[model samples]
Target chain A: MIPNIFRLTLPILFGYVPLGTAFGVLFATQLDYAWWLAPLMGVVIYAGAGQILAVSLLAAHAGLLEVFVAMLVLNARHVFYGLSLLRQFRGAGLKKLYLIFGLTDETYSLLTTRPRGGSPQEEHRTDVAITFANQIYWVLGCAIGALLGRSVEFDSTGIEFALVALFIVLAIEQFKALGSQKPLWMGAAAAGLALALLPPAQQLIGAIVMVTAALLLQYNLQRNTTLTREANHD
Target chain B: MTEPMYLAAFIAVTALATFLTRVTPFVFLSRHSEHPLLQHLGQFLPAAVMTLLVIIFLHRSAHWSAPTFGLDAIGPALVVVVLHLWKRHALLSIAAGTVCYMLVQQF
Candidate 1:
């Protein structure tokens, strides 16, 4: 289990460190923000999306209330991920709090695939271990980034697009893992439709609505397909 | 912006909010069996979340009316989609996209 965790997390660790470094450099040089604050943001926020939003809001001189509201809405999905994994960490004893706190998107993705038939205690340990590993990687990345920013002639121009590419890859991976084209198509359609209908400020809300509607459509389609299969069997 | 004060406040507030979001569900769920509505919602949340993320990516910039089909932007976007569809790796997609973006911008 330990070896598996290490292998799984190593890629993420490598990828995030440089990206974190880019972020640190951007904050320190471009924004003229403090150097140490970059890693501090990483450890505290632990969210790629939220960190970007925070930066944009700060740049725009957005009020604190606006930043808070935006962060809350963007991160509301984590609530669902946490709820789904509740049973896994229910009896985690002292580690439960840390486990929950470390439940980033990457960590959650890694934890969802625990091999079956372990003792509940073992399962809990594995979940917590995976979560810990991912957070440690993020922290390490952020720290390296902060330190690297001091001497290196760091350039952040155009690096922001990396996040977009990362998400596209993640979306494709989710599609492959779920073995369904319906969800992907639904997501793309919803995004396109929302862009057409909503104004800029309300675009996020429109996308959320479309996504929820797409999920419902997928659920119904899936349910009907299953019922038909069962009927055929009967 | 005074660096220390802004940084300190940003860290404190963000940390508090993030911690709350992460911890709330664990506390609620550990106390009870999963409710049916929660389960149903959970099942759909990932798709919804991913969809929203993609929308943000596509329309983040304010210049929606004048889409810049510049190679610096569109080239990388296309490369990312292709590499992701083919390689299915996050790191590769990012590296290829970045390189594509840089190369296009240089020319």
Candidate 2:
């Protein structure tokens, strides 16, 4: 079971380690905290981008309230992740708490596309195992990078592009799974519009709101079209 | 060195805020799991949300003011999409794409 879980989350392992290392190096080089604090943030916060943002915010001496609000808004896309997993996690038991806590973009992508375990009990174990393995890779990377950052000179520029690739791969996988261009087009349009109109700070939430409204409007359109056809048949 | 108390408070506040973002939908929408609207979103939101994320990242990666004008980002992004479509391996595509980005930016 443990080996299988590792295999399932191997891609995430590849992505998280380097990304976490980048975060750690950045934190260690820029901030005033000890190197160990990087991995500690990896364990407690567990958000790649959010952790990076926090480091920058702290370095800039942003207030606690500012950090709180910024982190919340930065991670707001997570709300949609939980909505999609509502059915899969219905009876996930106490582990559901941890599952929700660790529902990062990569984890959510992996969980949604994989086949379920044989039974509900096995499924919960698999979920927990996958989540735990990913975090271990993350924390391990943070430790390595932070230690290296303190002692060595390393250039990690362009390394974080791995995260961009991860998102692209997952988006392609989702497209193939759905076999529909509607979501892709709708999402791109919403993102484009939000990028055009909203500030960087608000773009993510703006796009999410726009996409949800568009999806609901699409649902109503389909329902109306079906009813019109039925009435004509009658 | 930053004070221990300040660091702890910073971590706690940021972690709590991030967890709240993740757990909000589950807390509010778990009971509506069977509703048609929620069901519709479950079926469709993943793809849409994933697309949005990709776009956001691409925007971030692009060099809006540089002379190359985002060619670095677009070139490697194309590599990623094409490689994944061909091999269907997530790690391979990501590794290749990152390498491509790193190499492309060197010039």
Candidate 3:
């Protein structure tokens, strides 16, 4: 079980290690009382971007309402992820709950790319292992970064782009696999429109709302048209 | 009150939101779902969500508010896109892209 978990999550470490390290370094250097906040955020929040924003807001002494709203908005996309995974979550008992809690963007993508292909029991083990391994890498990365921040002084600038790079690569993989650019274009268009119309802070939520609405509307329209055509044929 | 106390409250609020976001779909689907709609969203939404992320990154890296043709963003993103296309290895592709971005930052 351990070996299988390691092998499955090994690829994720490449991205998580560096990305988590970037967050750690920033948390350690930029924020006050850097050490505890670094790994503590790693354990609790566990969402990468939300953690980064936490550091920024806490350092600035942002209001609690402000912090809560920002974190909620930043991580809102996790809801969309749950929609796709609901079927898989059924009949897994309590572990389905853990699976939901652990559904980070990378974890979701990795699982989708290669499902836990085994018996129901084996699948449960594989998922638990995968989630554990990924979080372990993340927590370790934050710990290392906090320690290094206390001890060393060096340039680790531009490392956060590791995340941007990761997302780009993942998006391209999904694009290639789907072999249809409709969703891609629709989503990109929604994001672009949101960026133009909404404020910077609200752009993410706006983009998500826009994309989901557009996609569902198009889906319903297509289905209705197909139904009418079938009725005509009949 | 101390910073840790404040931080704990902050973490709790954030964690609640995060957990709510994660569990809502399960709750929603269990309550009610149109088979075609839910299934279509499950199949197609990942691609769309990923694309949304890709554009978000593009906006961040490029710094859209500046109103200039920014190579800072484009050059490295292109490197990632091209490298992924060529190698088909996730680690190699990501490494090449990060190194490219880091190097570009030097200039």
Candidate 4:
């Protein structure tokens, strides 16, 4: 059972291992501990980009409230991930709580877009295993990298481009899955507008709220127009 | 002296906040709401957020002074975009892009 989980998490293993190593190295060099907090954050925080940002924040002696708010902004997308998976998680029992807690971006994408199969019981089991395996891979990476902290001689710069590519691929796939270009383009427009107008720190939430408001307006307008036309027709 | 304490507090608070982001929707929305608005946000928000995220990376990855758009990062970024569009493989595209960027940086 565990082996199956490892096999399924193979792709994430590639991404997580290296990325977690980067996080670990950064944490060790930049933060309070050279070895400890890597795995601790991996287990407790488990946020990828947010954790990276946290290292920078903590290194800068950011206040606790600042750290909290910055992380909240960095992780805002997670709320949407949880919302999407709400139905799938219904009555998932104690495991359901785990699922909610484990809803990282990569995990959410894989589970939500995964091809469904087997009985519900089998599926849930697979999910639990996958989550466990992915996080374990991450923790392992952090531990290994933290132990090897700051001793390596190599250029690891721009390695984070992989994450950029991952998000692009994910966005494209999500766009394809939705099969509606309207929301996506509008989203792009909203983001561009926000980026132009707001501070970098403020842009994400601004874009999200703008997109949400635009979508709501679009939906309401379409509904009202359809209703009006139907009344006239009748 | 208090640095360690502050660090611990920072980690705990951030962890709690992160946990809430993941759990609150499930806890609260699952109880009182099945509204289409929530449903729509779930469906469409990811693509939008991800698009913005990519934009953020693109903006951060380079500091272009000339509008000519230097080949510094764009060449590899374009590689990623094209590879993803053509091959539709996430890991493959990411690997290719990272390799391309690393190679470019060597120059």
DockQ of every predicted complex = 0.37, 0.69, 0.61, 0.57
Name the runs in model 2 displaced over 4 angstroms: A1-4, A60-62, A150-156, A231-234, B65-67
Q: What is the C-alpha RMSD of each candidate to the true structure, in Å?
A: 5.4, 2.6, 3.1, 3.1
TM-score of each: 0.67, 0.90, 0.85, 0.84
lDDT of 3 by residue, A1-234 (tens): 687567656656766776677778788888768586677777776787788787788788888888877777788878888777766666779888778888898788766655455787677667767877888888887877777775545555556566677777777777787788898898899888987898877777788888888879988999999999999999
Give the whole-model CA lDDT for all candidates, comma-separated.
0.65, 0.85, 0.76, 0.76
Q: Would you list the clashing residue pairs of candidate 4?
A: none
Winner on DockQ between 2 and 3 is 2
lDDT of 3 at A61: 85
Q: In terms of lDDT, which candidate is stronger, 1 or 4?
A: 4
What is the CA-based DockQ of model 4?
Answer: 0.57
lDDT score at residue B5, model 4, on the 0-100 scale: 86
Off by over 4 Å in 3: A1-14, A29-34, A60-66, A150-154, B1-5, B31-34, B63-68
* Candidate 1's TM-score: 0.67
Candidate 4: residue A55 lDDT (0-100): 82
How many clashes show up per model? Answer: 0, 0, 0, 0
Question: What i-RMS does every model get?
Answer: 3.8, 1.7, 2.1, 2.5
Candidate number 4, chain A TM-score = 0.81
- Model 2: which docking level applies? medium
